[model samples]
Target: MFRLGWFVNYGFGAYGWNQQWSGNVAQDVARPQLFEQGAQILENAGFDYLMLEDASVLYDIYQGSFAYAARRGLIRQDPMPLVPLMARATKHVGIIATMSTSFYPPFIAARLANTLDHLTEGRFGLNLVTSSPHAAAQNFGHEKHFEHDLRYEMADEWIRAVKALWNTWEPDAVVYDEANGVFADPDKIHYANFQGRFFSTRGPLNSVPSPQYHPVLCQAGGSGVGRAFAAAHADTIIAADPGIDGMRGYRDDITRLAEENGRSGKDVKLLHLISPVLGDTDEEAWARKRAMNAAADADQTNQLAALSYISGIDMSTFDLDEPLPELSDRVNGHQSSFSVFAKLARSGKTLREILKSRRGQETVELVGSPQTVADRMEEVMEQVGGDGFLVVMPFTRRNLTDVGDGLAPVLRRRGLIRDGYPYRTFRENLTSF
Candidate 1:
């Protein structure tokens, strides 16, 4: 009963890092085009969806300069356009785009999501996020980012408003009854009249409910409030837990929260991120992993800079050989990343040492032959309970093809992952498992 999806970061120079040495010559084509092709591959592999993790602004926190972020081309484009492109390219795999509830107004989000859901025939999902970066606040004309828990509160209101708008038009509102001299049923439509401290929307969305009723809601954050938000609202929780025990604890905690909120905890699907380096043999996979790491080492400066960008901590000021300095009591960005790395840093390990450890570097790793990779995934899912995983494909097209051609078939034959999607809508496909 394990499921799989691709964790695709679609903005900026997403695959620019992979173009350095990968065998994919198509890197010359536009990234959006390449992304569409990749989506097709994932659909053929029976992946549930391809989610776009996004960052809106530049990462200048590392050294008080945008030069590093610009040079790396980290994440620079709007992620919305790619959604329809992906949906048009494939029929089954879901398309998820990231949008910030803190920044995007409820009406706009509702319209965009509803439109995309219809275009994809109910295969669209929204990964709702609260803008995390301090600079992002400046872009939105706010003095500073909202406090950690408060952002979630704002998101809660945003969800309520958006959901109310979606439900305003009942399912039968659009009844093209020509014989009755009416194009629709007036009683079927009603105003939302939703009012909240952070957001309020009146009346129904212009469009009727899409095939899935509402787009599948996804939440991905590494903080306590984030967990609560996901447990209460999201159809899927894109978890980034690296170890079995950690994964179990995260799932249990969220499930309990869901129950406390008077909802079934099992309603939230947990998907942990893993990147596997696959080969015909274990040694070869390890070799490939080392090569990939070496390439990353060449750009370690940008890598660490990007880390600073996400963690909201300027890592550049610290000496590589010195233990990490004490971080803030709480980070406004990815709280878990800061907490986890800080704990590792306290072992008296140098910044360099911590990044070098598998625990620090790889979020979730499985490097081996097909059988070995499959075995590890099965064991982890069994130990961690239910839900599934999000596979991080190497930026190279070859690695992408290798995953679909090399590993997915093995997973299908072994019955660890599904061979085909049984439902038409994304939520149905997810719940069908």
Candidate 2:
């Protein structure tokens, strides 16, 4: 059976806010009840994990105005506080929270990860991101974001420092010997004294080791430099290539990079990101997909604005009907994302056409009834080899029900996914297959 995970915004962005199926989520965005409920639903469906995607900037890049992102609720709240709440709601399912290496200090991030691991009882994972927005840098007192590869370079050092902190206390460091009046074995703890070009940290992590020792490292680096960083350190990688061939090539490349880094391909589990449209019947599902695309086509500016916010380019300045000029070298935000758009442009696609077809750019498409969708997913895994899929979708009760109560049953019956978690820790369950 393949591993399964769900990727969702932390009710932060316009994740079905004010949409017909959203219910009271928009009104309850500040509360934890909705997220807690969503976690339990995924857990009951036997998902391996629930990952919360986050961004720290109120984007104004699209048209040099923050109004667009603000009006659409594109600005995000911090996702850190919600990790323990969701973990408390689900016993087996893992809860992963996003944190940017660009902003967080290595020691602070390591300490928080340790604390969350204890709170979640080894069920916590941290998704590392090299933030891709100039606006985010401004908030952190930097005039501009670090250059693309330079940010990954910093992240590489950042992870090393964090790991050093995590390993400060040996596994046998904690021993409660009441008779001898000893709380822990002080000799077992050692200083990190880590120093690097971007960051430096001294001494052991104050918090003791939690359940997993080091919480599972998750990364979503799609660029060449990013892939190298993830290959060396990440336990699980979130891949968003568009098709099976691209997905296979990405996995193979990562496998090669892992071997070069002195680790086996199995050390890094790659999960392809997908958003499958499903219904009771095949026709209904296809119709729903068409409607979804039509809605996107009607709101081209909003789509482009979201893309522009991440790519750090004001796409509103470009001619929508003409193919884009080469802009990959100029992008300071997300080079991998810009590379995708540039590739589309090189193929003669107009900005308007690319925006219209952007629905599946972030994930592969699977549209059909439950059985049909499951069949396609099984075939995809077989073609791409092992590992699994991470489902990305709008956070609405209706959408959750469609996947958890509707499609999940079909997948479960077919034995395409696990019926329950066999291991206590998330890393164990994720690598169980």
Question: After superposition, which runs of candidate 1 have C-alpha atoms over 4 Å from their true positions?
Answer: 10-13, 18-31, 297-299, 358-363
**Best of the candidates, lDDT:** 2
Q: Give lDDT tens digits, candidate 2, residues 1-433.
A: 7878888854344467667676765565777777888888888888888888888877788889998877877756678888898888889999888999999999999999999999999999999999988878889999888888899999999999999999899998999899999978999999999989989999698888899999998998788998999999998999887788889998999999999999999989898888889888999999999998888787787768867876877889999889887766447776666676767777778888977766544456899998899998898899998688888888777877888888888889988888998889999998887
User: What residue pairs clash in candidate 2, if any at all?
Assistant: none
Each prediction's TM-score against the native?
0.95, 0.97
Task: Tell me the tens digit of each residue's lDDT in model 1 across 1-433.
Answer: 7888787753424564646545443453345667788789889998888888777787788888888776665654677877888888998898888899999999998888998889888999999999778899889898888888898999999998888888988877888888888886878888889888988788778887788878999998858888989988999878776688888998898889999999998788888888888999999999988887776655557557756866777788888878877766377877766667667777888877777663323345889998899888888889899788887654457767878888898888988888888888999998786
Model 2 CA RMSD to the hidden true structure, in angstroms: 1.4
- Which ten contiguous residues of candidate 1 have the minimum total lDDT? 21-30
Pairs clashing within candidate 1: 12-76
- Candidate 2, 265: how far from true, in Å? 0.9
Alpha-carbon lDDT of model 2: 0.85
